[model samples]
Target: MLFEKPLTLEDIKKEPFIIEHIKWDAGPKELMEPSIVPSCDGFIKKEPLKGYIFYIDTMGDKPVLSLMRHTEAGFAETLAQLDDMPDELLKEAIDESKGKGCFGMYPINEKIKALLKKELGAG
Candidate 1:
């Protein structure tokens, strides 16, 4: 079932990814190479996956479904960093390319948006 829970900026500002597996106390992260990460150098509140959570092998024994959540600030940051372009420029591109199939941020942004939603929880 889909869940709609509001999150606070303060919470999200702390962690962008919400790894439900054993909470944060289970010592250092099992995955040496952290795949999912928090944005803004650690300033976001990730929420647990609401549906179809992916299984992480690194977290064993007490496996817990998890997801990451970030504030709109993070989204804007991602929008900038992902394309390596300024937000103003991107927005302009989006406006110019609108209605043209696969416009500016349609195809590519779709993927990034999916990833972001995935990181947060079920979309």
Candidate 2:
């Protein structure tokens, strides 16, 4: 089933690792694995999904890394891209997160796309 609604940070925050039905082009829509750690062969760090991933588009006025994954500790460690990052770098992270080896990236809702594009000034 294709879920027309895209999940939000609030939704994720409410329930971590909650399976969400997302549109899949190859076949029927599939559920996205909460936090698939490729390095561990799709091993999830936490048993229950509590914290959700956050994509940092900008910090203050500057646009930092756009699609990098960040959890609770993960965010604190990275400090929300305090260091300048290249736009291309985010692609690699995104690919790795949504690759065949992993559960796949979370689907961004249409509203999210619009909001992000507006915030980022339209791609």
Candidate 3:
């Protein structure tokens, strides 16, 4: 019964964990709080979590699932800010962590991958 038909964003939203961890902000008020960030000054300059981000990628012959806690600023911008280094430096950093597991990216289980393929109409 895994993906009896092609899936869409709405279908992916059916996943339980995605709904729980991702917080959506309906307005500016949800973006900042004086209690958590004491220096909020009654307003936040940045956009807050707008929606859940569930993206899938094909790595080699397997499917990888990526769940990002998305904000109005978006995930790409955040990654770019964190990866402020030249290509050579990035390579060295990656090499140094060769055996360590990557954070936030995981290979989908075979059964789930099969189901997702069907849902994506790739099966």
Candidate 4:
């Protein structure tokens, strides 16, 4: 179920992690693991997702760095382009949510959203 007034990206940012629970989808939102796959094995800033494994890097500077599996940018490139998602998809979700008597549900990811705003290419 969704709230009458959806949570804004700012509000969602306060949380440790953001999730996008797609309704009626045949898959989970995203599966995370402690270790990144082969791509970022040496601790990289970014890496793309190939056939199966999308490596995440943690440089070990920040305390939470070691556990850093992936960044929002990498997440999108690997999975679906949340930032560049097509409008038709959004419309379809809205339709489905309404049918389920739900307003909508989604976790706000600032980094991805910011990238999306930039990708919009207007101001």
Name the candidate that leads on TM-score: 3
Residue 87 displacement in candidate 2 (angstroms): 2.0
Clashing pairs in 3: none
Pairwise TM-score winner, candidates 2 and 4: 2
How high is the lDDT of residue 26 in model 3? 26
> Which candidate order results from sorting by lDDT in descending order?
3, 2, 1, 4
The clash numbers for all candidates, in the given order, read 9, 2, 0, 0
Model 4: per-residue Cα lDDT over 8-113, one tens digit each: 4343334333333221121112333223544545753333321211111212221110011234344422222122244444444334334232112222233433
On TM-score, who's better, 2 or 3? Answer: 3
Report lDDT per candidate. Answer: 0.29, 0.33, 0.36, 0.28
Q: Model 1 over residues 52-107: C-alpha lDDT tens digits?
A: 11111113232122222223232211111122223454344334434532211221
lDDT by residue for model 3 (4-120), tens: 543344554466554554332121123332223434476444434655433323233333343334455643211111121233433443344343323423222334434444553
Residue 117 displacement (Å), model 2: 25
User: What's model 1's overall lDDT?
Assistant: 0.29
Model 2 C-alpha lDDT per residue in residues 1-123, reported as the tens digit of each score: 112344343433343233221111211012233334555565555432222222423334543432333233423122123224444453443443453322223333344444444543434
Give per-model TM-scores.
0.18, 0.22, 0.23, 0.19
Candidate 4 deviant stretches above 4 angstroms = 1-81, 99-123
Best-to-worst ranking by TM-score = 3, 2, 4, 1
CA deviation > 4 Å runs, candidate 3: 1-18, 21-49, 76-123
User: For each candidate, C-alpha RMSD in Å?
Assistant: 17.9, 15.1, 14.2, 15.8
